[model samples]
Target chain A: MSIPAIASTRNDALASLLDNAINNKTKPLGSLGMLETVAKQIGLIQNTRVIALEKPAILVFAADHGVVAEGVSAYPQDVTWQMVENFLARGAAINVFAQQNGCALHIIDAGVNHDFGPRTGLTDRKLAHGTHNFAQQPAMSSDTCATALAAGMALVAELDGNVVGFGEMGIGNTTAAAALMHKLTGIPVAQCVGAGTGLSADGISHKQRVIEAAVALHASATEPLDVLATFGGLEIAMMVGAMLKAAERRMVLLIDGFIVTSALLVAARLQPAILDYCVFAHCSDESGHKKMLDNLGARPLLQLNLRLGEGTGCALALPLLHAAVNFLNQMATFESAQVSEKSE
Target chain B: MSIPAIASTRNDALASLLDNAINNKTKPLGSLGMLETVAKQIGLIQNTRVIALEKPAILVFAADHGVVAEGVSAYPQDVTWQMVENFLARGAAINVFAQQNGCALHIIDAGVNHDFGPRTGLTDRKLAHGTHNFAQQPAMSSDTCATALAAGMALVAELDGNVVGFGEMGIGNTTAAAALMHKLTGIPVAQCVGAGTGLSADGISHKQRVIEAAVALHASATEPLDVLATFGGLEIAMMVGAMLKAAERRMVLLIDGFIVTSALLVAARLQPAILDYCVFAHCSDESGHKKMLDNLGARPLLQLNLRLGEGTGCALALPLLHAAVNFLNQMATFESAQVSEKSE
Candidate 1:
């Protein structure tokens, strides 16, 4: 898929709603802290009383990478497929979070090495059981990239709801995501790679070296999607697609940690339209997330030193999104509540 | 209220369910991280195919203290009421979080020294408008303490929710919380007192001295509640009551911030059963919370350097609780999914 179209926004309406909400609040100007802006934004977007959050949704995508055998990830390649099974079986962290927050969870097999044939539960949208090794060559060809994008858009089309979250599971995906983030954001791969699944200190160094090599191989690519086709796993490509669809649908995109954010960066680079709906779930303890978030100018909802992937960060963020929506919809207005502001 | 009871936990049933769930999953043991135990506990309690989370709630109790006049807080008394208004107007960070997480917010007027009246929208449960200056004399009388407890318990009865959170909005409350925790934990007030609203280095030193003096004033108190009744804010007493009722109802208690945790310490001392239902929402950057958490053997889920209260931590925790229920219900059996798992 080509870049998503940047939709026109009602700046006047959003600005007015923000300005009105702040002025009407009982607190001194800017005293409500981060919440002050959230209320305003919600008020602007929904175009009415921001009340009642409904149909929270979490989207977890899983894929495989050739880099797993290179010792970039702490866990083995089997862990990715194992976690996908866990997610489908509703035993994963994201599954638990989705349940707790009243979110309908949908897990997609974006790509993995093994066939999960005849499985009734898994959303089998695999784009070749894992991609070509980035160490030797591009992860997937251009045709596979288009197929992955289509698969992502398909998932979002089916699950349009109040908020959409993107979570990922892959053993060596961090090396893959960091490489893509570097290609799109112009940050070096070393700055973007992190311990994917509990990598040792030495494992991180090896992962860094692997990422640098991949970046070195793909340095001359001019286009973002081409870079993704070069180093992006099916999960990353699919996440980029899902985010675009969420943007088009005007759904809030709850972005998980490092790998997901790297996907977000790729999606945003391809289509600046996506940034409007994106909320960084957390600044992962992973070293690369900060630079990616800073480059995207994203403000994450949590900073729990969390590096657990599989959309756990995104699942955690589900509550914050509802909070934003609830305040936007609920809360008595200055006139309705009949509360007096300070002397000002 | 009498000391409360914990949920009738079928620990054996829970352990059995966990064994079955993990054995059936497609991953090795402990691959799901903290979520594994969480799922088993949910299965035990709900005893169903689908665990449902409902009645998410937060109690943000606001007040002011004469201690602020002594410059114990970095912000003025006005900010206390101002933040309360922010909470009521859904403009504070906690408000946004509460709204996002589907946690019903109940901001109480425990004693802001400002007349919220019946029309103020905040539930007017004030105890003497505000406490007497704790530095000079006891913050409140024993009768006032009883009244605060009554107010918190009454609110719990009215909200009738599945989960409860306790947070405070008094400007100088942290100083009082620190002094209380110091007395309870037998730690020095200097170690417990923290910067309440960004105190300068000189201001922190001065605040520590003031807390030391207050602790000295209360050192001879015969009992915990008596000490609290003498020096704690009306809101703190009310939280003890609120927490008691929450535990009695078997609703999960989400403990927030330093001041609120101090109330938990008081309530738990009065009845240890209340401790079983509590989930420490966060460790505030405030100096006291870490010590309080450690004393309780409680590990907080978030550590965002947040000092602003109003049940913000609970609001953030809403999603994790949501996840806990989902995993208990949604995961399928190994036979059904045909997934192979490693034996422990």
Candidate 2:
């Protein structure tokens, strides 16, 4: 899958608008909190009063990994199919959170081994029955990685909605994500490992070793696309494509927990501009995510002890994003409110 | 001014209704994220479907403390009056943030030495010209403490609207707050001390000794009322009143920064049920807040290195709270959406 070409904007225009907002002199210096920063960015990106309303949407791509067979996950590989079924049934956390936040849910079946038919509310973009076992070979083919990215970009273009988020579902995806982060950032997998989805201590060590083994195999692959082919999940590639497209369109990306952040790291390394389009939804209790966030130099919107995936954090964080949009659109300026300024 | 008396509800209806929502069986168990928890809690709290609309309001109580005369704050006491002026002009972070988030704001003159007589956007609840310099003597009369709490209670009783948030605007108020927290939590003022609104190292040491001395004097005082009168600022006393009243009325109390939290500690000791009506908005970068939160077992909603007060953090955080409420109210249940169970 080709990364969607991003639309170029005059950074000069953005800079000027940001300056105007910051210099408006309502409160004392730097008093507006993060919204001050968020507003300026929006003004620069949209280059307008912003029309304020952002459509909330998240794409959760699910795929089975060959590594799941290695017992790295607390849940069985069968649970991936089970959870996908639940997602389609709209019984999952992401589904409920989306409903609550008035966000749309797009479930992409990237490469789950189980066949989920049309009745399950899924979009079939499966590249293979499942990824190749990293213990034996590369996780996916380069072409398959490309195809997944294309699938995600195509969906974003087709949806034509605002503010798309990225998330993933698959037993053992965390192990894959941890491996991917190590590949992209050159961080050690052990440092990136944690008790994913309630894995026990033994489970964590096993998972870490599995990830280390995968990283050891994929160490020399320098190309982002090649790295994805070797170690990326179809779901992660799809997420990268989706994230790129959203950035190109200047839509907000409400990024979820750990595994997704690793995918974002890959996407960012490929296209550094993509970082601006991202909004981290939460600092996952998954310890690795904090490091990932630090390396990315990104601040998340929430810090709840959330470890569940399926784009639930994005759904949960949607309302806050909405408020950010609302405030930027509505608040009266200091001059209009006729409030006094602190003496210069 | 009279302390607003909060009323606790007797409905087992919310509890049963939440229990009903959890067992709906259409979604996977624990898939809905915080929205599900909010929905369940609200169902239990309201005994019906949860409905949240944006009438979010912040009452910022401004006062001057005698401690400022001791040169404890980085900025002089006049900044309080200046910032209050900034708030009314809607240029302050709280003003802009509040405006951005679609929340109404009321600036209350609880005990500021400066005059703010009946501005269009301000509520005058002046208790005293300012408390006596606590470095030399008790900050307030215990009766005045009762008066401030009564005033807070009174305001909420008239709030025939939506959620209520409390923030404070007082130079040198932190010394009073940290002192109160030290006495209340039995942590030394050293752990509780921080650079409030920016204090220099020597200024901080001076601030600490002043608080340590105040705590020593205040430690001998018995009863919550006695503690409030001896050590608390008028704005803090008012906030304590507001929190208790809001809790009694089942109105959400959006708590802000270190000083306000000290008032909350006072209210919580007075009525432990107060915490249920509260949402910790943001953990200020102030070191003491974390310890206070830990002691209270409270989790703040945001933590963006915020140290500015005047309810700015709460204002910035309101949108998130709104998001939480909106998701719970708007998301459809499994039975309503015809979604199947995932355990299938």
Candidate 3:
């Protein structure tokens, strides 16, 4: 399976132009702080001073995780499909936030165990019923992982947007993400594991043990794709594909919390330049997420302590993106506003 | 001067109901993080489980400070009126953000040194040409201070909104805010002073010295009103009145950076219950802002390193307020979505 090439958005000339435009705005230099950085990033990604976020979309991929059989998650595996139904019915947090922020929501079934026939808002892209239990064996065959990635890429290719936010609903997938994070980033399984969906102390310990055993079993899978195939959920693999494709298309990629960032870890390893098009939405309340973000040298836009992940962080953070771009495009320069600059 | 009585929004029965409503939403309990707190706060403020934020408006009080002559700020005092003109022209940061976030922007002339005979969209409420230089004397007389406070209260009384965000534009206002912070919080003058619009180290030291001398001269003014009269800018005094009035009316007061928060400090001192009505927008990059927020025992929603004082922080954070309310109202319950709860 061939990964699309993402070009480096490192244009010194364009960077200078963006800086000039941002600095001349009718406020103190760097007083806008992180917003100036965001505006510059968006400008760089678009390769233009006039940045436009057109047809912003959030694709929430849902699937089941075989890791659920190990009692790693607080909720049953059925909650995955139930939450997807909630998304379709417009009753989920992601649905409400996406609607509030004017982003179109697309719910995709990557590899859920249940079969829903001909649903209106649900996009069918299932690679299988679910991955095999990684605690006992590899999650998916190499071909299946490739197929999931390709499907994700194809979905973005057909979408009508220059920006896409990645979200996921997969019961027990945090276990999968933890395992993937451990293998890919060389972090200990214990450090990668967390109280996913409200696990108790003992439950978290047991979850860590389960992931440790899985990581030890899949120790030979050192390459990015091999590590992903061994431990990644179908939804995660697909998100990896979607993120890569979005970056390759020069669309701004809004990345949510742990599970989504785990996919990004894989995508970034495959093509490092994809980081240029990516925006780390928030540092979630989920344990090890900050470390995961730190590992990638990412500074997230918000740290709202959000742990519920149907790309809710991404949806919440979309406004900051708009604010960043709006300030860049609409704010007056010191010259334009006739405001005095800093004292010489 | 009559300060409006602010009733505490503390109802145990209603708090229980708001918690039940929030926890029953289709997400993990406390997963929404600060947003959950904001939702509950709004619910309690409105005295109902069904929370609604209507006709949100950002009132930007623009003024000029006499303290600018003491070399306490980086920009000239005239920039205050210029930025206000920028706001009126819809080309300021606050205007751009407020417009993008569906917030009505109100530009009020609290005490700018300049004057336009008649301008559309500019609310004229000048207390004086500007405050008297606090370094040499009191910023305002007891009567003038009282009048400023009354003017702020009267302005909010006529505004048609359940939510009001406070922003300000005044050169050298941060110097005034630092003085207010020093006096109200008993924090050291050096700790409270910072780079207001790009002050150098020497400039910050000079600002600190100016504030320290002024603070010493006003040492006898221990009462909040007397302290405000001694140190606060007209915009800050007006904001104090506006904040108290807004709280008395139970409007969600979205408080901006250091200067706006200084106004809140005075408001909270006079009516301690007013803190309950405030939504601290962001912990600005402006030095001493974090300390000021800490002094109020307030946890702000966003910390984007924004130091611009045009209520840009308030406008930027408005979407999160909407999201918090939206999620509370729209999301499904565990039973409603048929999503399984945590395993026993």
Top TM-score hit = 3
* Best by the DockQ measure: 3
Name model 3 segments beyond 4 Å from true.
none
Per-residue CA lDDT of model 3 for B1-344, tens digit only, reads 79999999999999999999999888877899999999999998999889999999999998888888898878777788788888888888988999999999888899999986689999999878889999999999989999999999999999898999999999989999999898899999889988889999999999999988887787798899999989889999999999999999999999999999999999899899999999999999989999999999999999899998899999999999999999999999998998888774
* Residue-level lDDT tens digits of model 1 in A251-313: 667788888998888788778767766667787777888898999988776766667677777
Estimated TM-score for each candidate: 0.74, 0.81, 0.99
Colliding residue pairs in candidate 3: none
Model 3: residue A145 alpha-carbon error in angstroms: 0.5
**Clash totals, every prediction:** 18, 20, 0
Better of 1 and 2 by lDDT: 2
- Answer with 2 or 3, whichever has the higher lDDT: 3
For residues A103-190, could you state the per-residue lDDT of candidate 2 as single tens digits? 8888888888887667556788888878988877988877778878888888888875667888788877888888777778878878
Q: All models, DockQ values? A: 0.18, 0.23, 0.87
